[model samples]
Target: MEKFPGAEEWVPARGGLPKVAERLKDCRGCDLWEDAEQVVPGDGPAKARMMLVGEQPGDVEDKEGQVFVGPAGRLLDKALEAAGITRDSVYITNAVKHFRFERRGKRRIHKTPAVGHIVACGPWLAREREIVKPELVVVLGAVAARALLGTGFKVTEHRGEPVELPDGTAAVATVHPSSVVRSEEYRRDFGLFVDDLRAAGALLA
Candidate 1:
């Protein structure tokens, strides 16, 4: 099998999550390390059956070193509550561990991660999937769909649909929570986003 770009060096050849964390702390596999505050590794149970992956860390996540803790996260929390999924019940992470941004005066505007950035970060995400072995992967955007599914992934066509991988793990794609925040029809779009999350959670029932 072909190995992902930085997997062997970054993820443990032997250890578990802690080891992954250690390598991630000093990862220089990509230039994203030069600008971001730190690696925002996935957070939740060690063996969660459901994994929720997003695009990348936002400004808040970069500063705090936590996944989904900003405006987007707050919205996700609300939707998850409505969906009957507890925050602690699943793992949450980003497609890219580091924040890629363009600095404006006082703020760092989020820049969509280039393909190379995602390719470089693939190993860490693969390791996360390997370790967690989730029964369900909820990809929360086109970026995440591409990272977890493939380059050809289209959220518009496949969102909320359960796709079975060759390995037999199940994944569903959806709009990132941030999209709802950016949408002009926040209320309507937010409802649809919650519906998608509810469907993903339904598989567990």
Candidate 2:
């Protein structure tokens, strides 16, 4: 495990999303950038009411240079629609901007990012939160939960329950969309995921 100084220095003290996105490309805050194709920053309106945060970019997202455009993303879109939450109304990003993976033959299998990676990427997520100031943050898995809420936050225990942060921002945790995509009981799991989203949506309402 390597230690990084974190991304605070790379983040501009005064700028909006565009400036953050542009400067993110040049961040050497962690070694994850060494293998990643590019940094995939958060995407959505500057002042969305909600924000969705995941663990990190997948192979497709790393290649495409976009967030929430993979199979999991497609499922997320469907789930959001089912929850009566418009996709365009929320901002989406990952806790870590780079794609972490293990090469297996011709395939790049997704690897969960270590805590250091999340810590290294903290500044970027903080910047996005500051700029968006979303009414509620939807954390899509344990990694995301840890990034925003802190370590020891468990999605299984608190899924669909809105928790107030130290800053008074609300957040809800749920399994990653990929988990539902990979579930044996796909329909059931997806339905539950939508239910969680709907609960979060209700908080917004």
Candidate 3:
């Protein structure tokens, strides 16, 4: 199976945020657990007001077993700062918890999680939402949008706009920080990215 059948099997009986993470540490939800150093579970408060979801871990994140500690994460921090959002104000996690990669020579290049992987990893996200119950869920990049919104959702068409989730919580779609890093127009794209964060922040008031 590309994705795990569900995250429930990995969930602890207590089902607290910490237990969720502890259980996830041993998750074999999908084959991703086979290669990664560890499962990169969500990081932040148990009841954070906002939750940020990215696609998957990058090179640095995979090694560190943290969701956002690398370049893209640093960039995301800047965008959040520019938008008046503090690091403590949001819970951050990846839509897929593992790093899927392909090795070339000495480098392990990041590979996008396939649709089946996304579907497989759906349970952890649901578990995170159940635990945090955030007022807003920010979807960064197409992969997250696909997992939370639907496969048909596109960040380009929906960026900076708030949409209602099936659970009724407000969710917003935006580009991943990696996209801005890759953009030729870093300044321009970063500005737009910050704008999207601001929109998400505005709803907090």
Query: Model 2: which ten-residue window has the lowest total lDDT?
Result: 162-171
Strongest candidate by lDDT: 2
> Residues 6-120, candidate 2, lDDT per residue (tens digit)?
9988998888999999999999998999999999998999999999999999989999999989999999999999999999999999999999999999899999999899999
Q: Please, what are the lDDT tens digits per residue for candidate 3 over residues 13-97?
A: 5567788778888877678889887888789988899999999998899899788998999999999999999988789999899
lDDT of 1 at 69: 97
Q: Global lDDT for candidate 1?
A: 0.86
Who is ahead in TM-score, 1 or 2?
A: 2
Report, for all candidates in order, the number of backbone clashes.
Answer: 0, 0, 1
Task: Name the candidate that leads on TM-score.
Answer: 2
lDDT, model 3: 0.88
> Which scores higher on lDDT, 2 or 3?
2
User: Per-residue lDDT for 1-205 in model 1, tens only?
Assistant: 2233554466676677777777899787778888898888889987998999999999999999999999999999999999999999898888899999999998899999887788888888888888888899898998887777787878989888888755678888899999998999999999999989999998877
- Evaluated at residue 194, the lDDT of candidate 2 is 100
Report clash pairs, candidate 1: none
